[model samples]
Target: MVSSTISLAPFFSLSPSASQSQPPSPFAFRRGLFLVCHAFSQSESQADKPNSWRQLHWKEKRPRRKANAISDQEVVHQFDQLLAAKNLYQINQYLKDHAKTSNNSYPTVFSLFTRLTQAEGIGPDEYTYAILMDCCARMNQVNLMFGFLGRFLKEGHSANNAMIFSPILKGLCWEKRTGEAATIVLYKMAKLGCIPGIVSYNIIINGLCKNDEIDKAMDFVDVMMSKGHEPNVVTYNTLIDGLCKKGEIDKALDFVDVMISKGHGPNVVTYSTLIDGLCKEGEIDKAMDIVDVMISKGYDPDVITYSILINGLCKEGEIDKAMDIVDVMISRGHDPDVVTYSTLIDGLCKEGEIDKARNFVDVMISKGLEPDVVTYSTLIDGLCKKGEIDKAMDIVDVMISRGHDPDVVTYNTLIDGLCKKGETDKARDFVDVMISKGLEPNVVTYSTLIDGLCKKGETDNARDFVDVMISKGLEPNVVTYNILIDGLCKKGEIQKAIDIVDVMITKGHEPDVVTYSTLIDGLCKKGEIEKAMDFLDVMISKGLEPDVVTYNTLIDGLCKKGETDKARDFVDVMISKGLEPDVVTHNTLIDGLCKKGQTEQAFNFLDVMISKGCDPDVITYNTLITGLCKNGEIDKALDFVDVMISKGHEPNVVTYSTLIDGLCKKGEIKRALNFLDVMISKGHEPDVVTYGTLIDGLCEKGEITKAKELFYEMISKGVDPDAVI
Candidate 1:
């Protein structure tokens, strides 16, 4: 007799306060039972009220039963048939038995409850409420699910069965309320005399793993084992996956051993996950060993497994090994898919083997596997990076021909390539094309454009692009700011670059090590050594360690300012900071020492450099030779050239030019001409400096005809004479 338009809001309002900090106690759920039952009882009481218009209307609408009316058994049987068929609408109609429907009707379960109470043969039961609870859980309506649970408990159907609470545990976990799910498994179900089964524990553990609470998830495994519930393969696999994702591959492997010893043999998913973890850690060889072990265990690697191996090998630059794996995969009858081919192509491209990469694309099509968007994009990126911008565009055209639209990533790659080639204008034009194709330029797109402009010395344009990027709602990230700062610094606009850093900080962007290093380099270039040194101190204070480049820049600056001793001290400081001096560091220091006329001291540093296992490059030998030549040690300088050649360092044009200048300075005009001939014969073309030195030498030796002939020969060889000539 009650109106079917019953509201469950008042019952839900009786739920624990939303503002309650702690989780609701088991007593709170018990208290909720009374509140929900009270609501149901109130509705029934109003319908039963004597002299009530609702009761009168209900009496008039009552239909008389036939002689062959359906029995309670028959009704219950029909309800089960409908439930099995999942015919919710028919179930509602059969419960109501020709009752009037209303706009504000309650949900299907509540309507069934209301009608079954009024039905002739049967009423709502514990089994019926279980179905209702499941419905609420499936719909992700956890509050409604709890209300059904409260109703189930109130009706004295609180049996010691875990299935009844399964829906509750599942609903809580699905809503990311894993903590509540755990409470139900650990305490609430126990308090209700329901033993939590393996299913219940696994759901909670999987939920915890998903929440990244791996350690807490492991604790639950211990709790379940203590409670006499053996952890199954699903349980172990869940824990292993969590450990692998957290980069704890060793722990994941340990879990696998535990699983094996417990008679739950490691499955393909287990091996695949471990392999992926090892590959991510750059242990490609170990990952391959894992694959061999998987095969020994009678598990044939699937396409996904093989693909993972191929990807690992490719990442380690073992392209040939990756190809061999693909061959082995094919021999085992696992056809290489697009991902496998794409990964190989990417590896080849990274190694600068573009032609080989392109051949694989054809092979993929021959295998009847069409390349996806990712495959096309990766190939495009590789081509662009190789400075093959035209070829990359052709591939984009081919991609369109194949009915795949070039995505933002494809456009961004093209723009970056053009920018690196110093074609900023062409790169900017790609943005308009990208927008035309309905693909909005993301942060990478705008940042690449800004970088292009900055590198081209168009800092003002780059700044304007930053403003435009903000206007378009794309906030410049730290990389974008760094590019702009680097540009200004390179332009010798140190003050403007410093101001940009201030603005960057104001915008909540913290300057990283690169930012401080760039600032220091700029200060050093501007001869602001004290300020540069202060910036270095500030950098270290902020917990940003100066890299080798930073130390080398400062050293180079000090040496240029006639502070060779200070530069040498910085090398010691760099070593103390745990940064080993690279070749550039040695070269910078040697050049600094040589410029200060400390040729013998520079030789001492070279010995120290070799002792430290830092091999002297051609620049090192050239610096020492220049220092000796300036000290008028032509014989020693020439001997040093032999030492350079003997050490497997070929004498470059600079080497030949330096020797010629040394000989010319010593008034050995004939010897200088012979050195020039030796320079030419070694395929080292005489640059303007080389030609100019020989020409000056000839003119000074009173050989006017020979000097004019050499000058004309230099011009014929396309070596432009400088003002020094």
Candidate 2:
């Protein structure tokens, strides 16, 4: 608080006028002795008693000065050097001690440096401020950093003082306190009369980009240019990288043009940033173009460049191309590292080439690249997805033996796999093992377990587990709510599902598309179509668009009610909204039409379907045939069956059995018997349904002898007839 000066004389018993004051306080004496021993130990040699502090006045002249003394230059020169050196040393030790332990000493030692230097008429140099600013930044003490900045500015420093701002900027930016960094440079530094130079601006720009403030970062680029600070490649790269990550890759590439026009041509990092952004957008070909451009610019694509392409390719399900790039990467003398191998492993696993992925892991090990936690995690996740959970656990054991600590992601994958395989009890045991290994269960971990428990028909246990998660301070996320909602729906507890949805909203959670879709589907399945419609309206009102699943569920409900026309009308609405109906939607409508005896209308729907890019599969044809048989349009159905075969669509047993049943129902018992022989010639053996359908049709026609013959033949084929037969 005493900014005027720290009178070192109060700490020492250095009083020539002894009668003027009381004895120095014990606290003052101890502090003075500590300062003398710590700072002025070298000056003690000239003391009369070599311990008596009467001659010392910190930077005071040897004896008390009245008329004249050593010149100010002589006194200041010696005192400044001594003060700066001692203060710098003390400030460094404080920083070192604080860096290792608690940094509570920041204020204590920073005050000592500034005050002692000021009292000695010596300005604290860059080294003094550098250490202090870094200490403040590391401690996240912004106020202390600004205090040092104010002092530095007061010393008439200018834009060239990067040394002052650089460390502070790095510290703030490193901690992602970029907005504060920009505040200091954009407003504070200028207010203090030190217009920020390019380095300070660059740091702030990178921070802004890092904080996802791409527009703000771009606007600052203008400020940098207006202030006559030419934006360097780093500034452009930072802005471009941010823009790309935000899915503004085109805007990023525009900056690439701007950068080159300004003569700060993009470097490896700039090109790599663009490549990564393009690849993330699934523009792998565009990324390759960028790579080619980099080579044309005499900058060879580095490992990161190729890895970005590989990652992008793999994501697009282009694993073959990703592997080709791996070969290309090796030929370029840039060996694929663990990251490269891990990405390939992940890609291969996703492509269901799990065995190939396993072999690649061994190849990585052979190449002397010890798989890190990520590599092991990728492999474990792959094995888990393939339902080789025991293999995943074995990998985990091997990973542990090799000193690779399986991260939470690894265990979560395993737990999820077990849960999906209906091993909820095993999953619970894994959760305990995870805790024993000092791995805390995160939201995903707990959520997966809750889902597993709910799936195993343990709804009460899942509800209790939610409380346990809350007790542990892990809030249930939207996925967790959706999983529980699904479980409640499956149990026919519609009210509970609605109540949970309400709770989700009350808890400040926005029910996303999945949440609404699950509720709608559940209601549809339970034949609560009107309630499902109500949910649909609420979902739209909440500004959430009804996705394909939402629309499909409602269509399915209408179709199941034999309201094919209503379902057909809903499909038009979906298309009007630019939501293309998937194959499931078309098939649902087809089946509905068939059930309502509109077999011909179902054929018309199929024609309209192919034109709209929704292909009718085997299920669609089977539904139409059943409708025809029920309508006594047996011969026309036979011609359609020939059309199906000519179109390379094989009619399975459903088609054959439907035709034979139609014939027998029409009292063409002999023709139906011959059709059965045709079915056998096509390598299609009569199963229980096929035999039952024929037997029922024959009995209804009063052809007991033919029915008995078919019954004996069915028994010879080992086809057990149902009670209906």
Candidate 3:
């Protein structure tokens, strides 16, 4: 009602493919029903019914009752009785008696009914075979469906009939046989005189779209138009959905205009697909803009649309804003499903707001939405991260008690937590537990366990686990190799790590940045700087450009070796590669410069940092203060601390302690004690290092009484003194 129109083509016909030979009774019942229906169309006037009935099977005149003489229930009851008794003859009679609307919705039951008949050696009726096609679709038994269709056609039913072709065509589509489905719709159906109607068209188009053959699907739309079939609303919706899924939102919107022009209204599904696509593409604002348009079109956004937006916002760390949308969603009469609540809970947990996340879980339950495996996993994962493994285990118990099976993710979370806390034996035990529970360990499971074993210096056991993973038919991915390599490097088994890299590359598992980085760092730590550079060159040749971590590792190694000039040159090379220098890069450089007595050069670089819009953080200032103090520029260091404070950088205990130790080293006891007083007044809590510095200064000055007094003060404050004190 709102737009323009497109032309429909002529309904092209094909020659009948059936042979002249008489077919068996399988087709007899089917052919009779269709012939009867065709002879007397539904659009025919009721007054012509009696005459139409007399023409059935070309029989002589007989007393004829009105069509649909028996009720649907009576026919169903008759069929049920016949089927239950396994009466083949009566069932045959029953099928022949009621080829009507009464049995339409119940045709799905024919698969089981026919199988029951098969037990009694009774062959299925034609309609039974049709339903069996559907049964195969349900079971994803594509080949069996084709076999059934072949028998149906051999029994002499016209294969070209839209009724005959539709089931298998739809079944093929259901099984994701998009290319095969297209073959049938384009060639086989055309040869059989069966031009696909909108239903079959939509099925193939949907299959094509799902297979990411949207371009081909669009080409099919043109073919349909050429065949005089105007693209219907379902047709257009499928195309739009396909485009949206392909991340071509602009194209999808343009297609909507085409749809509107065709006078085929965009339905809820059409707009919802667009909204979901937008959210996934991280275009939430545009998605909301489309939502407004959808609502303005008198189409109310359903739960799916709202949930998509909720999840989108959550992923973007817009939890408060997402909750606001959730309120709006509820007020708009859409209930938040488990997915929506799970997404929100996950977002909150990621932000380290565990308590807030747990409260939301309660609210979700109060709304009658049961927490699914994903929800429990999210909560358990959050608790584990916060080092509350006991609470996490309690949730695992609750998850089981609530009848939700703990999935791989759940166990993975527990395993990861145990690994981080160095309770790896427990992590090892959980693997067996998961297997006992009938849950297969995925790549993540094996990788995590291997990493844990590697961390505990159980590399041999980690290797055995990798074998166990392979034996269980799991392929170790690049990350699994990287973990092993890193472990080897840490244990000073650099050759073993390099061998793993070689094996990975030989196995066609191209080494990624982590793999190369781990090897480079290992070689660098071994003082094989030349080898590390060779690997860097190899990595570049392979087009794996080194990231900032790569540069940082190299620079740190060079600085540690007192090769400050080489490290500085490496930093310039790193910058040339389009990698920005991070704080770690700056800190490493400052430490190197200060050690080389280039403290002024380090301070000059600080100006360069500010000029480049890099705010000098506490670590930045701490390094500078340490550097200045080391170079015997104690007053300059004190002035730098003021500058750090003026720049709004809070001086940590390390900052103050560095200065105190400097003054103490210079035998400036009174000055050091004064600085300690200023540190205490500035709300800085003294650590053992801080107290030890002051104590050592007093003891060195032969002020044993004052040192003893300070030691007791440290003990009273619960700060333990060093052995030196």
Candidate 4:
């Protein structure tokens, strides 16, 4: 016997010369040669003797042969006849097959099923309703699925089939109605004597994890175990991923141990998830250790694993280390994909290495990897940070030319750049462009604009943006509220700042540390130290720890009011809170003490500052010198200038002006004249103050000729003498 073969060319690909739109019809051969061959193949398999080529050719040539002759309409007519005879088993079987084989044409299958049930003398059985329910589930009409379930129960069908309830559980879980899914799995399924299998439980667990209901997901795992359904690797991975995402890496690691003990070893996905969590938590070293453990277990890290590690390194500002990993990835035959390159670009941009970041974009393009929206956004962010807004705009143009529409993040980056450069108008225009492009400005976009306006002292304009943002249904977050309060404070509108804080709380935006810090600083600047202190107590009561900026603000406020002792007491309080005083704190204190004629006390604090390893900056030394000169200690002030220079601090115009006035006030006329020559020789031009002090000294000495000559010299130097002269 010879086996006949059918050529698939005519049934599949079209000829090169065939009209592209006029290909062979699928139904043309589907109802003809395809069915004839199918019937012949079945008969040949069951035959006692193989059929000859002549017999096979006869079947192929006469595709309308009896067994394969029925048209689709005739088949439907026969199905209606079966339904009329109440042969429900056959009707249900046909419907079940149709539902399963419908692919995505679920609505059509459902319509056919509905018409069959509505036929005269036709009633759908339990299996028919189950098929209908499955159809509803597939169509995302899960609400209509319940109607089919009702029909199944009304027909007195057994509810013991777990498969029948699986679709319902899946639909509910997919809709994030995990509470209902759980109720069905725990109570309704039991009521129907249908115990859910692992697949059904896994679906609910996965959904719960995705919705950030990790605790509830874990409780279901316990229930699943109690019900004798052992959790699989997928079950454990879902829980681990949920825990990791919630920043519960320790708990996620514990789950990994539990998973291994239960004989389900962690796979690449499990390790990658763990590494990603650790990286996000800034535990890059620990993440690397996990990767090593993964490799020791014979599971080589894939591209995703490498990308996660690179991202972690980039986030930690270890850009060079991240690049080393990229090289290792390529050497190991895994290419650095767009995500890996984008992560590196973001890192470089953050480090202010904009040129290097652009070079990376070139490298990525050279490797035939198209820069994604994230990659382009990162480059734009880098340029914006470097104050190259025009170049950033050029990158946007290039991004558009490459068919990549700028996403919300891309627009937000551009807005942030423009606003920081004091181009608030341009930023606002971009907002319109974003809306025109069908992307609504998100919270970050509005927040950036609000912050820019506030920084430019346009508090009124900033307030308008806040109102617009709310009208757009985007509520002001804590950062937004903090920006508004800080702006109001700088404008001396403490009452308005407080009102904004009140509105923030009313809107359920609890004041974080930044909010309280900004308020404290504002109140301090307004000289309402007592109220600022009261806010401190409120902040502490609310469990928000005041940071260094808050304490520095309070200390500066007290020192300014000649309350140096109280400022000292606040320092002790700040230290007690475990926040060591920074340079700003010490400078504020020194400036306060010097202003109060407590030179010895100021010098004592200076020693303490040094002992605490807080090096004095130029302001620190200048404040001390100003105090000495005010106390008529000319020699001491002069000596301190030498010490300042010895400490590598270059005295600016203030330093020279202060010393010149000190010498002239002491009537050291020759010394004052010599210091002026030294000031000029040191490239410090004499300002009106410097010359006025010298000219006044000459007049007091009754040297009218020298005073006139000095005044003439001041005029020649173009130093505009003020009324004090």
Best by TM-score: 3
Candidate 3 local lDDT, 180-283, one digit each (tens): 77777767777656667777777888888988989889988888788778899899888988998899999999999999998988888998889888987999
TM-score of 4: 0.68
- In the order shown, the candidates' Cα RMSDs to the true structure are 14.4, 15.1, 13.8, 17.4
TM-score of each: 0.74, 0.76, 0.77, 0.68
Cα-based lDDT at residue 165, candidate 1: 75
The Cα local distance difference test for each model comes to 0.80, 0.76, 0.77, 0.81
Off by over 4 Å in 2: 1-160, 163-180, 642-725
Q: How many backbone overlaps does candidate 2 show?
A: 0
Q: lDDT tens string, model 1, 1-725? A: 32344333322222232321222344564364334444444443233222221232223422223435555566567766766666556665665551223211224335445545556544555555555565455444566566666556665676487777777777777778888788778876776788889989999998888789999999998999999999998899899888987899989998898898989999898898889889888999899999999999999999889988888888899999999999899999999877788778888988988899889898889879888666777788788888999999999999999988876667888999999999999999999998888767777888899999999999999999999999987788889999999999999999899999899999999999999999999989999999999999999898988999999999989988989889989999988989999999998888988888899999999999999999999999999999999889999999998999899999999998998999999999899999888988999899988888888888888998999999999999998899998
Report the lDDT tens digits of candidate 4 across residue range 224-266.
9999999999999999999998999999999999999999999
